[model samples]
Target: MANSKWSHTALLVIDMQNDFILDDGLMRVDGGKAIVPNVIKTVERARQHGILVIWCDGGIYGEIFWLKVVREHDPQGRDVELFRRHLYSQGKVGPTSKGSPGAELVDGLVIKESDYKLVKTRFSAFFATHLHSFLQTAGIHSLVIAGVQTPNCIRQTVFDAVALDYQPVTVIVDATAAATPDIHLANIFDMRNVGVATLTLQEWCEADA
Candidate 1:
């Protein structure tokens, strides 16, 4: 879309936290560090185009409690996803624990005072969050997403955005990552198959130009 159309678009910067991007982080995604520059550039371009910038942070205190309580209530972990149940049962404090250094955004990614910040507990930014209402209030009907680990947070958020009826959902391929290149490309292919627009940072920026 053109710059003029970006007023209705919001860029969702998902989980670009130190834990996911830093080499020594608890849950480091190796490719995440490589994409930092592209993500930074995409954010700059989005701001210049007048697109709303929304940081979808994953390590809020409430999320910790939410997961803890949910797992506690379902001690058998029946309510939790099969893959994550073991972690919850073991009482593991994930990378996004509140007030942890891992929860903070990567050093190079900027969160301007004017940018919107939404903390999410689950993979989907819209899950039990006011993101939908906030976006609606701001008249945002489209989204541009960038961040680490395409298989989880990025994919979940994009899928949720689509289910929420956000049109023209776009994911910047080079600006996002997964544990491996194959995993990243695989998720991108899935998103594309679902009608999500997958583009490189350069392509996305030029589209607004």
Candidate 2:
């Protein structure tokens, strides 16, 4: 791939944290383990093309006391999404808690010092985050996504990217996953219907050739 072809593009690696990709993680997505190799390769290809690589993980950083306070006050999870309300209410620390092992990126995926990192609390990387502003400031007009659990984070981020007018928002199919093959394909189909470019790792790597 040529650098100029993807110079304005950014690769958004969503929630490739240990919790979602490792087998023994608290919130492990079984299928996620299989995609690590593809994800790594995709990241490498993007880097070679000079595409900005942004690692977006599910982590909210703050003073320890503040986190405790928020969790206590919102014990019932009135502030969280409806689906996660029950889990949060039960005091589940969940994946990507501050300082947790699950919050780190999985093995084999490299995040060099030059790469950018964004921490998000919600499923969508854009929700309540400065991701949009950062991309805009960096002149990023397109996105290539690779990461885990297609049904939630992946889908939400892609939808938001489209809404934010990021054209040609591509999702590397084999570099992402869901709990099952059916779920993965279904979400991919939905993304494709919305004009999202759904490509396999190989196809995406060769897109600018």
Candidate 3:
């Protein structure tokens, strides 16, 4: 297939920040680290296929925490969600808070100069954000998603993408995770029922090769 086959597609890497995926992270997902390699591989494949890479990261993407990692908030936690505000309270550092250690993307998943980074403050990247507008302007109609914690951020984003009529909303199964295998698989089943194309990293990366 020609490289332009994916010209209208974008690979959305969501909430792979340190705090949500690392071993000692503030709110670690037990299955996060295991999926790191697959997620990294997915990005490399996307680039090889000339697909647009957009990093949808921040402190809020995963359960509204990872999506907001890319967006830093006031020191007093003024803009943080009600539940996570305490992480920034009393001089404590919150996970994925801008300028905080946990807010950074984990090693090996660097955002390249050619890639775009989006900051979201909710479970869905499209909610309260210009992601939809940007995608439309970029002429992107298909989205391939990868990230941590499937039930919250991944599912919500996928659903909104469907609602917005983004065709072929693909999710890399091995590239996304949750606290447990059962949770992850169950959510994947739900997403599949909604017409999502859930495939493994290898299946997606090698399909066009």
Candidate number with greatest TM-score: 3
Candidate 1, residues 1-209, lDDT tens digits: the string is 23556667777888888877898987789899999999888776766666777778411111010000000113344444466556435666555566667777788875554444576767777877788887787677888888877998889888999898999999999999999999999999999999999998888867864
- CA shift at 58, candidate 2, in angstroms? 13
Lowest summed lDDT across 10 adjacent residues in model 2 is found at: 63-72
Clashing pairs in 1: none
Model 3 CA lDDT for position 63? 11
Residue range 24-43, candidate 2, lDDT tens digits? 88778889999999988876
Q: Which residue segments of model 1 deviate by more than 4 Å?
A: 1-3, 58-94
Please name the candidate that would achieve the greatest lDDT relative to the true structure: 3
Name the weakest run of 10 consecutive residues (lDDT summed) in model 3: 58-67
Q: Which sections of candidate 2 miss by over 4 Å? A: 57-93
Q: What is the per-residue lDDT of model 3 for residues 145-180, given as tens digits with 9 covering 90 to 100?
A: 898779988899999999999999999999999999
Residue ranges of candidate 3 with Cα displaced over 4 Å: 58-72
Reference-based TM-score, model 2: 0.84
The TM-scores of all predictions, comma-separated, are 0.82, 0.84, 0.90
If the candidates were sorted by their lDDT against the true structure, best first, what order would they fall in?
A: 3, 2, 1
Which is the better candidate, 1 or 2, if ranked by TM-score?
Answer: 2
